[model samples]
Target: MPRLIWPLLAALLLGACASKPEESPERTEAAQYREAQSAMDANNYLTAIDRLKELEARFPYGRYAEQAQLDLIYAHFRSQEYPETVVAAQRFMRSYPAHPSLDYALYMRGLANFYMERSFFDSFMTTDKSARDLTSATDAFEDFERLVTRFPDSDYAPDARTRMVFIRNEMARHELHVARYYARRGAYIAAINRAQYVVQHYQRTPLVPEALAVMTAGYERLDQPELAAKSRRVLQENYPDSEYLDDDGQVDLAWWPREGKGLMSLLTFDLL
Candidate 1:
């Protein structure tokens, strides 16, 4: 009731009235998600990624947290950050195995790995992708295979199937490339083993005939006449018109581009 006490009370009331109220957790989460979604709709993936990461951090157990994680994978992929895309996708899969979008996460992980070795300059270069190290391609193939096998009815299954085929072919071709490399270097046993890997694992691939040819040549060089005859017989039976076979039924490896130009370059992976 004192005059000085009344003034202090009035000041306190004014301060309380001017202070901002804290937003409810649910409302805050929803608003942040909306902002991220709007950025994505506008094709601002960088902004979306930032907002999505912040949402996940602030609302770790919030209702929109899982969805934010899922969007982070896609936004990283769209931004061409392949490694981050893979990490985000894999994290989502591990965090929410029972989520309805699990198939999407697997598919995106596969896609991210599939393009891991490629760069923007690849589009303008004529590099032989199959001849390069195919570790990422192999990983992508397994990811796609798992998706197709576990969620065959998922909307992503069809595309995963298609990518699986391409990866399989690339793997088979990579094995064949290694086989030819060993064969060219007169490492007969190594060449035969590599070629047989392709034959045993990639039965339906187009490169099977070439693998058989490598095996035949390698066996002949190793003085394994019976094995060479067996490989040649199989090639004749299954792929009589294969380009690797000459008119005399011999294994002709003259078609390799690197063989004609320089042996050192072929072995050094173009380091020359």
Candidate 2:
């Protein structure tokens, strides 16, 4: 009787175990993706990243893999880990060049740079400890330009155009600032060249007014009074309300001045 009972119990346990349904691979993948989504919703970005990575590894060709990759990139960005965010975004672009989300990925890549750029004043003071990020910003702008040019109808195009404007203005401002530094130090030749670059290359930029003011000041410092007067006249004519001019029709101190003693005298003189 004991042997018969034991055999029956073993058979019953085996039947119960065998009757349990096996989870389909699709179901497992769905479960993982759901977990990742839940983590993300909770703002547990690190956990979500780990879960999504696992999902991709286990189901590379699954329905959720692409979304997992996209979310991973976003997670890195949300974590303020820009380098990782860039890496993930670039990977997405390379892997799925024609994906509908490619535009978004490209835009994010550029936005990362925009956030990384130093303020105009910081760069001006030469106190920009974040100068290294400018390289990233330039690369991001290039990516954004590519997207706008290649996918003009993309939803991101307008934003990309706006960002391009910002980047161009920033670059123009940077050049103008360097020109101002040179002029202040009596490096009139260098200042004039930089100012000319702004005028010629970035004529339509917001910084044009400032660039023209710098050119007027630079020409004055270089003893090119004729050129200086022409530049000032143009500035006053084109930008009548420009704050670049003082009440006496003179360039502000922020602009270069003509009346200082020659560079040699200023360097050699000892004021008592």
Candidate 3:
């Protein structure tokens, strides 16, 4: 029994010695970052995401951790996984509010929502979708505005500002589209409401002319000749060259009124 005990003890000691020591966490983190960078370079975003997440979870305490989280955002965005991009960007912003890379996080957050707001329906819908929900587009615009406000000197600011213009146009167009739809359906009051909203809230937008035109059309439909004339007066004053206006700079009563059928009217997008 004593001999057997000695052999068992020896075997246990040898097994312990043969087992590999735990690798240093710092080294592992560095390796993970390298791998992620390599994958990103190769455009293998999913692989980069896996390595970046692992690095972030294991080492949330230094520059490497911050880089990991930021890399995760780029990986998700490059992969066209927009929801994940938004989540990661928000998380980075929350965790590192004063991080030097905050501008990047904000820009990416806006970019994610920007893509989410884009859809084939918006581009090719038969009817204008002013009444359609524009929550995502509005959200993206806010994000961009915040980024521009907070980090005006950031390299991303110029692009963010440009995108803000696009978002503004989309929103204003949405309102004008709804107003036109309401006018077409003989819902003059609703048409006036939406058109008025665009003119008041979204001034300077390219859609302003369209909104004023809708207001004029709506008032005309409601048999309020005075109000209709007032709307036309505003439209002509602001947009003398507007296609919606006649040679006399009056709101064109001939165009939209001519199309009287089951088919929906289409609008050409002129956003910059």
Top candidate by lDDT? 1
- Single out the weakest 10-residue window by summed lDDT for candidate 2: 124-133
How many clashing residue pairs appear in each of the predictions shown? 0, 0, 2
* Candidate 3 Cα errors over 4 Å, as ranges: 1-27, 120-132, 253-272
User: In terms of TM-score, which candidate is strongest?
Assistant: 1
Name the 10 consecutive residues with the lowest summed lDDT in model 3: 263-272
CA lDDT of every candidate: 0.87, 0.80, 0.83
What candidate 2 gets wrong by more than 4 Å, as runs, is 1-27, 118-133, 255-272
lDDT of 1 by residue, 1-272 (tens): 59899999999999998896966666488898999999999999999999998898898999998889989999999999999999999899888889989999999999999999886789698677778888899899999999999999999999999988888888998888787777666567888899899999999889899888888877777789999999999998899898888899887767333334477767786445
Pitting candidate 1 against candidate 3, the one with the higher TM-score is 1
Q: Locate the minimum summed-lDDT window of 10 residues in model 1.
A: 253-262
Residue-level error in angstroms, candidate 3, position 189? 0.9
Per-residue lDDT tens digits for candidate 3, residues 89-186, read 99999998999999999999899988785566665665544556888778899999999898999999999999999788888888777776666666
